[model samples]
Target: MRTLRRSRSRPWPLGEPTSPDGQISTVDLLLVRAALHAGATPGQAVTALHDRGGVLDTTARRIAAGEDLPALALDPACPGGPLVRALAVAEVAGAAAGPVLDGLVDGVVRAAELDRLVRTRSAQARLVARMLTTLPVVGAVGIAVFDTGARTFLTGPGGLVLVVVAGLLVVVASWWMRHLVASVGRAVRDVDPLVVAMRRIGRPAPGSVGVPPTPGEGLPTVEALELLAVSLAAGMPLVEAMGLVARLGPPAVRGQLRRAADGLRAGLPPFEAFPEGLAEAADVIDISRRWGAPAVASLRLLADDLGRRAAAASEAAAEQLSVRLVFPTTLLLVPAFGLLVVVPLVVSAFSGFRLGP
Candidate 1:
């Protein structure tokens, strides 16, 4: 029962979304795939898309209605920015839309899952930060409500000094914990510490989160594999693909890709062509090519696995964060509360005892 807009002279580009506002989303890809499977022409599929008002839909409509696809896709406003870049490369390189799109869909699914995992895993740490922050405000309000002399104590001899010290502790501790949480959370997310340090050196390019080539870890290898998958899917030779990767990948891995490409060109097998930590990705490409298996699918699976490992790392980091926050956070708050609320009430009570006697 889906409608098709077949009357348009140019059929919608196969596997390419017709455009709209800059809001491209994964759900848009799902819709496009569904429409294509349902025998809808590309134009009809664009018209059939339900996200007409979203970023992806708007961008898709623009592309369908004759806007420049590559320029628009690379525009910062493009929805599903990373996915659009992938599609743009496919369009430019004449890659088969089916394999490319299938890989893209899998990548998006994994990204969404990773996002959800991070949110769930970070919940407890965020909650603790929130609770600790609220204590000072709550203590202030409660003391004012229950203790009539609270006003006197706060405004009295050492009252101003007490107020200043307590305020400083609460403010400083809140700021410290917040900064720590963000830093540790980023570390868990596989964010590069070096890049974080270089934040003041001007912004990094968009969609540039290729893993830094840390020794022996999985992220760098996974990134290399995914790039190789794209090149192979585009029909590039392994040697040429490695060379392209060398030119385009993160600075940390370029030398490795270059050496691998040189080795490949020298008639070495992929397993031997690659450097330490990258041989596995090279082997994957070689084996998959030899068997004529879909390399894109294998790369997508590797990306999914890397995402899971990052999530696990984030969870473990959050657990450690919970332990680290306890003593420092608690000690700061407990003293402030005692000075601001408990000690003030106790002083007032002793004064009352003397007057009553």
Candidate 2:
């Protein structure tokens, strides 16, 4: 099996001109696909894409000059990203150009859609975070610094008590908000978009979205299902397709699928050859074997249906973020407003009435 490189957190090597955030552009993947379709070598494809101009452009020269294309694709720092990984896998496996191209086109479409969803959620999160931090601070500062009457009240014993309580509320609110927001970010980061779409294929029914499977555990099964479906569509034999998937899929999932492939070679029935998570996939294959119904098309439709459900789930999560913010706003900001602005101004008014008498 070919070894996959570990993802690095260090600065990008080879001076790749990607965004600081390390996201791969969809345009770059398409350009590479076009170049490859026109009979360019993998290295030549990247080199040709330089003129189209994006993050992937800068790495073209290096790839053309014989830098390990697979290594570059696997580099977390490489702007080529997951689509590049798919292409590199296809190239290394010497799979037919048609299947590889089909996978790449499908992968690009899925990646682009998922990227849009992620970007929208991220932007909304940033806006909510800014509002949470700014609104209360601005209101407090305006009352404390600008109002002369409230400024006087702030110097007395009552103001000291208000300051202590408000400070505590602010600290708690900040911590709680950070905790919630960080969890949301972690959930998004923990699963790959392709994995999510792939896993949806094995799920028993449509729209049965559940807590995301733990990273690494469910990967081999679902990944094998997708790869096997695609390969079978391309007319690869069942055992041969499983073996290919074992080698070409991500390193993390390789060992498990390799065993499944071995089982198939040992004459195990389709259902017994795969992991329990892949029972639905196995059933489809079993049907294909007995009746020659097209498993690939059925699985493709299943994948697409589940992909939409996954996208909808992400949209729902983004929308829920606004509702979640209400907790911190009510608990901390509202009380802080009363302590910082309303209470002080009311005290200032009462004191002025006493002085007038």
Candidate 3:
């Protein structure tokens, strides 16, 4: 038998270096540079180089530029390097499996941002709840203490009765305050309707990632569709028209429209470019595609539907509030008012009609 020739493969490097503070060392930066030179993007290079820690965008870019990673890592602005390096390692692993690095970056970034928002909202709600619960209890105790001192200065049974009445009032007031605080806590815990509605509307379509609109930014979906229709009708390229709208429209709409434009640019069929969220308006998408006319007509119809739904919700909320108020006024307030006005008069009249023993 012929002797088999041994095949030799290049040996990989040993462990990467760490800073005195346990950050990426200079050697790691060189490795990242090598990855970039081998055709990886700056993001990919960072992902590939840092096998165990999170990588910052700035540091990643610097590594791609063949800079010393350890020096940049020590900069004050480059905080959380270890966590970033770990994330970068996961990113690289995903990429090595043929997934897109940019998608990973986008997902990680968006999730972090959303988590921050949730944390902030939770903190605010907690603070408000604490204040509502504490302030009333403190005030009630203070008033009760003051009333006890006032009682000490009085001597007669009438004065004792006054002190008891004041004590009773304080107890009742404290209970009321506790109830109010509980109600407020319940409200804080309950999800806001507007938040629910926005979340529903903002859910990304299949294969699409939706971005939140900036503050006071972005056109409504109807407006964006209308603009797209106009631009397309005027002979503008789909991609160019989308870019124009993104530039002129609100930030929320811009990111979405830009994504749609990207799909178009990437050679996705026009009908496929329709947002998944627009499935409820499928007929419009189909009709627009068939007629090649402005998509404005379909968008207008959808807007009408949205308007009607909004109006219905508003009407229902108002009707419920009115019904609730009516019961409270008629059952509680009216009886209380009648007792205050008519009962005293009847008692006085009865007292005047004395029967002889």
- Among these predictions, the greatest lDDT belongs to 2
Candidate 3: worst-modelled 10 consecutive residues by lDDT:
1-10
Residue 205: error of model 2 in Å? 26
lDDT of 3 by residue, 127-197 (tens): 43334334433443443455443223323454345445544543443344333323322231122222233
Evaluate residue 60 in candidate 1 and report its C-alpha lDDT on the 0 to 100 scale. Answer: 64
Better of 1 and 3 by lDDT: 1
Q: What are the Cα lDDT values of the candidates? A: 0.56, 0.57, 0.39
Write candidate 2's Cα lDDT for 1-357 as tens digits: 001111112222211101133333455656766878888766667787765555566567667667866776544345544344455545555554445555545644664565466556656654766666566557767877888878777777888788788877777876666655544433432334334444555442222223333221212233445556666766777888777766555444454566668899999987898755456677878887799677876665554544455445545655566667689879787887778778888887787675433
Off by over 4 Å in 1: 1-26, 35-51, 61-65, 111-118, 121-124, 180-188, 191-224, 239-302, 353-357
Worst 10 residues of 1 by lDDT: 1-10
Q: Give the worst 10-residue stretch by lDDT in candidate 2.
A: 1-10
The residue-level lDDT of candidate 2 at 54 comes to: 55
**Candidate 2: segments with Cα more than 4 A from true spot:** 1-22, 50-62, 67-78, 102-129, 152-168, 171-225, 233-236, 251-277, 292-294, 350-357
